[model samples]
Target chain A: MQLDVVVGFFLLGMVAQLLKAPIKMPKGLYESLTLFLLIAIGLKGGVALNSHASGDLLIQAAAIIGFGLVLPLIAFPILYKMGGLSRIDSASVAAHYGSVSVATFAVAMTVVEANGIEYEPYFPLFVALLEVPAIAVGLWLARDRNQELDLKKAAHEIFLNQGVLLLVGGLLIGWWAGARTDSLMPFFSSLFHGVLALFLLEMGRIASSQLGVLRNFGSFIASFGVLMPLVGAGLGALLAHALELSTGGVILLATLGSSASYIAVPAAMVVALPKANQSLSITASLAITFPFNVLVGIPLYSVLVGHWS
Target chain B: MKKRAFAFEMAVSFVLMALGLVLVQLGLPGYGLVVVAAILMGLSFVTRKWVAQTANVKVAAPKRGNH
Candidate 1:
């Protein structure tokens, strides 16, 4: 399978940052790019589900939820015991890994589409499903038992956070509009990769800046950051195959499973897990895992999955 | 466990995930994930126990509340 060309933008961003080249991604452009990708992805999934909903879809979604929950459980012990992080730090890191990354998923989608690989469009639905569960699991790990937990605060952060609200909202709107959206596809569907290219360029610059922090943390976070996604992607493949997803679906699921959340989870963690160092999670996710996924991991999963089946 | 040991453990975990996927493809669609999760957790518990016993050369606990 061929690597997506947009990945070049990520590398370019990193290079620009590394060279200390004067590059400013206009204020809030990153946010706008993120919003575009999120809605585009949600609309794609919503449009697919608008026609494809069935009992079987529910079963697949339930499986995706299980997939989400299981990832952090696997990650926490490693970070806590083996990596020797504090309990909250380990859980925070685990939650970051356990949750899915939209940018990574977007990369994977582009990878498959570039390869002419046909995946199920309902994947964005799975992306939405994969977002929150790990955050919930992370909150459970981070909360002090004696502390009076704010259920309302937690609910708002988890359910109505920027990522969830826009993705779910877009999904609902896409479903509501249905074929009426055909005209707008020129903007949403056609311009998606270009928008993603711009988004990744900014992400590249940002991720490059986070590297030193990950380095300071030492080898385990870096190593786990690289390897954990492989584990998640492997399980995604198995589960997708079990669900009897198409080959493209298997690739997409593996990509989704393998990614760590740099966007949604970090924001929610600030509100929910106050004691957990937000930067630690960000450094690990964005600095370590994000680049790896963007540069090497996406293609690696594709090749691995291709060889598997 | 040190970083090296943790890396080794992740390697084992990756292999276990593939093994589970193969099992699922063989016929047991529903149980493959459970099997993978079970064995991985079991591996974690066992390794941590080993790490505790060998506690001489451990990865230093991370400093917290510094974010």
Candidate 2:
């Protein structure tokens, strides 16, 4: 298959990650870069949807949401049993498989945008919604049957965690406050590309930093990371087509459904499912599968969307 | 299954997603989405770091006892 630019960026990011010490992006800048990417993608999607929003689109959103919830339910057990993780670890990992990664989805959106492909604007919103259920399910899985559940801790982790709140929160505020173009536009619009570029740069740094971990358990993690997303994409596409979504809706659904929640899921997992091996979850999401999805996954999904839709 | 907490998070996530959808419905343009997402994601990262630190400190406190 011919490699696309987004995939190239994904590779570049991975290369930067592998060479982290020499390519020094400050850790502090990482999140900021990711933020920029999401906002940029969101704005573009928002602009596109101005003419297109309808009842069918909402149905498609529901499909994406269903895909997000279902794919993890199917994939996590395989990952857990095959990867030799403890039950809690498996559940945490499984939870991540269930949630969508806003950053990766953002990157995919950037790719689709650069390619001039039309996709649903609500996809990111679906991505945000997708983050929660897997977490709830994962927590349920990880919770000790013998011990009384601590409602307070669960509440804090779910409600207060920055990732869950911010991406979803920002997207909602921007959507509801529609056409606040005079003042809010400049801040949201001008600064996003620079932020994403920087975020990718920092991602390079993070992937590289995680290299040591990869070499030790590279095979198992990489296999799962690559396979899981494909599993998600497959399920997403089937669901979209079954729902008779538009081509763009189908593509967006596939991407959202396939994408893993590296940021939101991992952060929440650290609190919600403490016994789970975070390093494994983080490495799988960020180091192994994330780059792979961006590079090969998006184009592959495009083709799948193209062929299936 | 803390009813209140679960409901709050689900509610918050639902609102965020809906907000994003509405933004796209309007003609505010692409950069607006990016900036908004960037700020939210950045804040999330900060909060994640804070939580991680607390989790680590809690983990380490008992280790100190062994020493």
Model 1: DockQ vs. true structure: 0.11
lDDT of 1 by residue, A1-309 (tens): 455899999989999999999679789888998999999999988888888889999999999999999999999987887778888898888899889999999999999889888888878999999999999998787667787778889788989999998999889888888888898799999999999999989888899888766434654566577668878888999999999998889999988888999888888888777888888889888887778677766776676666677
Q: Top lDDT: which candidate number?
A: 1
CAPRI-style grade of the A/B interface in model 2: incorrect
Residue B43 C-alpha lDDT in model 2: 38
Residue range with the least summed lDDT across 10 consecutive positions in model 2 chain A? A1-10
Worst 10 residues of 1 chain A by lDDT: A214-223
Q: What share of the true interface contacts does candidate 1 keep?
A: 0.18
Q: Give a tens-digit lDDT track for model 2, residues A117-193.
A: 77656565666667787788877777788766667787677666777676655665556556664376676666655
For model 2 the local lDDT of residue A190 reads 68
lDDT value, residue A132 of candidate 2? 80
Global lDDT of model 2:
0.64
Point out where model 1 deviates above 4 Å: B1-67
How far residue A229's Cα lies from its native spot in candidate 2, in Å, is: 0.8
